[model samples]
Target: MEEEKRTVRAVERALDVLLCFASRHEWGLTEIAGRVGLHKSTVHRLLATLEDKGFVTRDAATDKYRLGLSVLELSAHLFRSDDPSVVLLPEMEKLRDEISETISLYVRDRSERVRIQAVQSMQAIRRVATVGARLPLSVGASSKVLLAFANDGDRETVLADPSWPAQLDLQTFAKQLDEIVSTGYATSFEEREPGAAAVAAPIFNRSGKLVAALAVSGPSNRLTPDRMHEYAPAIIESAHRMGALLG
Candidate 1:
């Protein structure tokens, strides 16, 4: 009897060709072939198969191949299954209860901050920041917490924008970032919305990378300087605990 094959070299080669896109957005046939250590003919065949399966697409003019929507669909399903927002719900609820103020989780999105989750205060006189709301990173407490911990490249990207905070120059922004890093939190008094005040702390993953911001917000009258100073340590502690619970 003929010996059974333990592995298909062709399939492995095809997979290598696909993975070549991990570091590159697009590649020509020759470039992919070289990167995957496969012959040009082999890479071409693999690209044809991948394109047929909607895992890759070819640019007609540039003769390059790019990842296709199939990858996005797979990633979307994976992310939806274990959303970080799910972990945030209980922590945000705890914060809202502790402070009796609106609590929101914001993530950096390009040049802005997007509210991904929120728990409103129990009191009638409270501020309510809705989920799915997007605001500029230049003007809010939560946004600033994210900004303070952002990678240098990301911070520069935001600061380079024409709409960056008009009141703060580069030197002032750098100094403020230093302060936020030292304190591990930030505050904004009616900086984004009128009559609103918020205090925020950076939420890190288990790896100590900034992932999100947890903020307590309320009316400017109630979230006074004294109250902000009073609640800041609690907010920072909550952020620390919440980060420990994150995956």
Candidate 2:
């Protein structure tokens, strides 16, 4: 029984070391040990085990540790089933075809948003975003739509964080969120990435929980504000259809 308890405690300490790397740009062994409150030797052993498993890696030059590709591979495996790519690719393709622009799907992870799927139009002039891109919730139309539709607790938590990005003034952000909630959609110009405009709407499940966002994005020169306004209805309708399917 005592041995089992010791094993569980070791596992917990190892998990603490792993989690310490989550938000860091990179960390060395001493930093990881200090953050995890473990001795250097223990942390080194844990890191070595994790590195052997491909869950972490150390830079040869910098000697800093960061998450490894194997972590991403495992995450992708888990996401493969519930991934928005699996759920919304067909709709995104259709939207891209109809609008001649890029369509993307995003989901909220705490105060951040992650693009899980995207389909770029066949047009020679197009904006490209790779899958698995992460962005702050306060930046883009898609992220804002997800934030505005999120439960009140989540909204409050994100808004209350002092470290939250402050590119947009709180008053303006608040008012925009109110409008988005009222209209069930959101729009942005040159917010997330410069020279880009986007329109986004929320997807909900049968239980009425916001699950994801569907967005159409393009170069501002071609997809002007007027064009986004014209496309808003279709994007919202598609989100509704996707919500129903998720249900």
Candidate 3:
């Protein structure tokens, strides 16, 4: 994020152009210039530089630009190099031991949330979420926090899905998501699985992008609505520690 504090206007303008591509796939010269509030000439120069570096590509017939293969390659590199579960296992184990509840780490995958890592509680009646288990975006504290903090485009993609709970209308769903963002956490009581209850907090990278959710789950008999609040501070603290390590 230090780069964002830079005095270089050229770098900032170029980055602004790249950000414009996140909301849309293709952009004409005029459209890109208008979005970034730069002159067409300046945008043209920036696009040429970005094109030379393989960060963007221009369509010959349509005279529009899209992200280039190099950008995809960079994204691939980031995924390959940034495996959070490996770095977070120790802290997760510590949290699990302290709380005596199942600790699960989930990341957003399209419109679903997938448990990428988990440490089960010792109790025989504890709730369990296996690694690689995909759960709906509409249910569970883990999934809701992911949806709540996701980028606007990703959030829209999940919201527009037919499976997003019909019981809650779009505006109601939006308000719930906004509440999660405001509170810094979310809770569920058998929303996804019978008798299960959970409290989840968002985990973010240093750049402030949410990367995952850390949740603690157990049987509703033990982790009832009243007791869920007791575990909130612990989960939120663990999320902060893990998120700081991510940076």
Top candidate by TM-score: 2
TM-score of model number 2: 0.74
Give the Å shift of residue 142 in candidate 3. Answer: 0.7
Which candidate has the top score in lDDT? 3
Whole-model lDDT values for every prediction: 0.86, 0.85, 0.88
lDDT of 2 by residue, 1-247 (tens): 9999999998999789877765665899999988988899999999899999998899999988999878888876675555556877887888888888999889889878888889987888888867777788888899889888888898989988888866668778888898999988888999867899889999997789898999898899988888888999999999988887775
Q: How well does candidate 3 score on lDDT at residue 179?
A: 95
Q: Pairing residues by index, what is the TM-score of model 1? A: 0.66
How much is 202 displaced in model 1, in angstroms? 0.4
Residue pairs that clash (backbone atoms under 3 angstroms), model 1: none
lDDT of 3 by residue, 1-247 (tens): 6665664878999999998886678999999999999999999999999999999999999999999988988866553336887778888899999999999999988888888889999989887767767788888898889988988898998888887777878888789999989988999998877888999999998878798899999998899887888888888988998888886
C-alpha RMSD between model 1 and the true structure: 11.9
Summarize candidate 1's per-residue lDDT along 1-247 as a digit string, tens digits: 1222424666788789877876678999999878878789878888999999999999999998999989888867654534667777887898888899999989998988988888999998999777767888878889889889998898988889887768777788778987998988899998877899999999988998888998999999999878998999999999998888876
Off by over 4 Å in 3: 1-81
Candidate 3 weakest ten by summed lDDT:
73-82
TM-score for each of the candidates: 0.66, 0.74, 0.66
Clashes (N, CA, C under 3 Å) per candidate: 0, 0, 0
